[model samples]
Target: MKFQLDQPQGGNSISRHDGQHVWVNGRQHGASLLVPWRGEVQDWALARFDDLSEAHFEQILALKPELVIFGSGAKLRFARPALYRALIAARIGLETMDLGAACRTYNVLASEGRSVLAALLIEAA
Candidate 1:
């Protein structure tokens, strides 16, 4: 499947794929596992916090997603133990990766049949 995202002013449009890839202005952005999902792509603004502890929880609360993909910049990091526990409590699945990887994962999951939401912090490339 292919999606056409509107380009922001002075920015390029992002073409998302059902597989593990995203195209920005016709260039592949990243590589990742192709996990298809059934949901909408939710965008949120985040601030600097000690890890993605609250951000994950808040996004889950707001989006009510079956699964959440966190795009934590350019490197993969496990969510804080507290956050993981919270997710478990809420019965929400959580996956963390770098921004690009998260984007790919989001597209994959969205393509499949899982209800997915993404909280990303990546610069446009």
Candidate 2:
């Protein structure tokens, strides 16, 4: 689906998303990725939800976002809390949702200037 929102100045916002891809700031990305409110969008090495590990969350922790919106591909699934223990220890909030919802929610929070990261898992189509 495509989104039309008044983007916050100088910030990145999700412009579109579907099962196989997402568009950030008008650029299309075909793989799983990390979308921070600002800064370059990063290709997350996660190819499937079942492959998630603490190391993945640790990578996100390094980015230091106040909150993370984890998109579990086309379905709403929660990760093992133990996998993200480091994030909890650091006082960062984590929310899980299906891909589409994550994209929308990330845009809303990002537009509000919140330090949010969208850790989306875009599985192969």
Candidate 3:
């Protein structure tokens, strides 16, 4: 499974998969995982953050994915209510999980043709 990145819309970007891992402007991004071209291209937004609460919500909003997965690095926690509410207002589903879990979930959802966005914080393993 490869991921191909379309030219960014401003600082934000949309990456489509060709086969393997996800790429941003031809550079591989470890923060994201891309599955093979299944059928319909699933839309996704990915952002890296040090603190999930401080992440820029506008980016996710711009993508307008059906589901939002918050990757809280190696540690997992509930997302702030404000963030959840914002997604709810946009009619997006929100899932908060560890980064690894989120990555796996993103790949599975993408393969299944479900729209998903991921905010991942990388931690030293």
Candidate 4:
């Protein structure tokens, strides 16, 4: 599926997504990546959900977003709460979903100018 903004959006918005990849503002990316509500896109360096660690969640702390959307590849998976304790302590809300749903949700929250962060994991082929 694809998402389009009726008018121009300031930051990057997910344009399309599927089982294998997600297109950010029309640019195709197959690797895990992070899309902030505002800022440059960056590689996430995660191949699967099991590869997640507390350090990974710590990296997100620097971005300072009010919310986080974690996309667990093609299937819906939940991460251990301990891995994201920093977010909880910092009062940052987190929502977990499949990759496609995360992409769609990111677009909606971002368009509304919310401080949303999307940590999407695209499975390796």
Candidate 5:
């Protein structure tokens, strides 16, 4: 039962991932999403990196994660500070990287018992 107890709750291992989808605990998500260390997985409505707005970052505040890993689609992209001012003010940690890297790092951190959230944006294949 170790495998079953690995994750603290329903949000366990990310079973699989690809260019267009992510599977958490065997559940497939075809769009960008917010994977937290615990609790529910949220569907992040970011269609593309360029479409990211201040509102999107602000919306993340409601999740109240201690750290946020930003997955900028398949390519690596950075966000402007102005777009994430709320996160700064909240003293939340932020890390930016390509989608693949974000997903991997999120897995490690989450398993280690950290409160991390991965915000992944995937484009059409």
Candidate 6:
């Protein structure tokens, strides 16, 4: 689905998401990636929920977002806390949802100028 809003001056906002792909600032991305409010969009190496590991969560630490919106592919699946212990230890909040919800939530928070990061996974068809 495509989203409409008064785009933030320079921050990143999700334009559309449809399970298999996500459009950020009008650009299409087909792989898992990390989208921050205002910064470089990083490629996340995960391809499936089952491949999630501590290293995955650890990689996000470098971005230092106040909150993380984790998109667990096409469905809402919770990850083991142990996998994201590093984030917890750092006091960074993490929220999990299906990809669509994550994209919508990220857009709202980003537009409000919140320090949010979206860790979205795009699973294979």
lDDT of 5 by residue, 1-125 (tens): 35446545545567678879988877999998888888888888889788999988887888898999998988888999999999999999999998888888888888878888888888876
Full-model lDDT for every candidate = 0.55, 0.94, 0.53, 0.89, 0.85, 0.94
Compared to the true structure, candidate 4 yields what TM-score? 0.92
lDDT of 3 by residue, 1-125 (tens): 75753332222232432223444334555443322222222223333333444235655666677887766656686767775566778787878887667656676676556666665544333
Candidate 1 lDDT over residue span 46-123, tens digit each? 333344466547556655668878766666656676766766778888777876677766766655545776655543
User: Which one wins by TM-score: 4 or 6?
Assistant: 6
TM-score, each model? 0.57, 0.94, 0.58, 0.92, 0.90, 0.94
User: Which of the predicted structures, 2 or 4, would earn the higher TM-score when compared with the native?
Assistant: 2
In Å, residue 14's CA in model 6 sits off its true spot by 0.5
For model 3, name the residue pairs that clash.
1-19, 1-20, 2-19, 2-20
lDDT at residue 10 of model 4 (Cα atoms): 72
Q: After TM-score superposition, what is the CA distance of residue 50 in candidate 5 from its true location, in Å? A: 0.8
The predicted structure with the larger TM-score, 1 or 6, is 6
State candidate 1's TM-score: 0.57
Which residue pairs collide, candidate 5?
none
lDDT of candidate 6 over 1-125, digit per residue (tens): 77755678889979898888999988999999999999888899999899999999999988999999999999999999999999999999999999999999998999999999999999989
Runs with alpha carbons beyond 4 Å of true place in candidate 2 = 1-5
- Minimum summed lDDT over a 10-residue window in model 3 is located at 34-43
Residue 84 lDDT in candidate 2? 99
TM for candidate 2 is: 0.94
User: Which is the better candidate, 3 or 5, if ranked by lDDT?
Assistant: 5
Per-residue lDDT over 1-125 for candidate 2, one digit per residue giving the tens place of the 0 to 100 score: 76765888889989899789999989999999999888989989999999999999999999999999999999999999999999999999999999999999999999889999999999997
List residue ranges in candidate 6 displaced over 4 A.
1-5
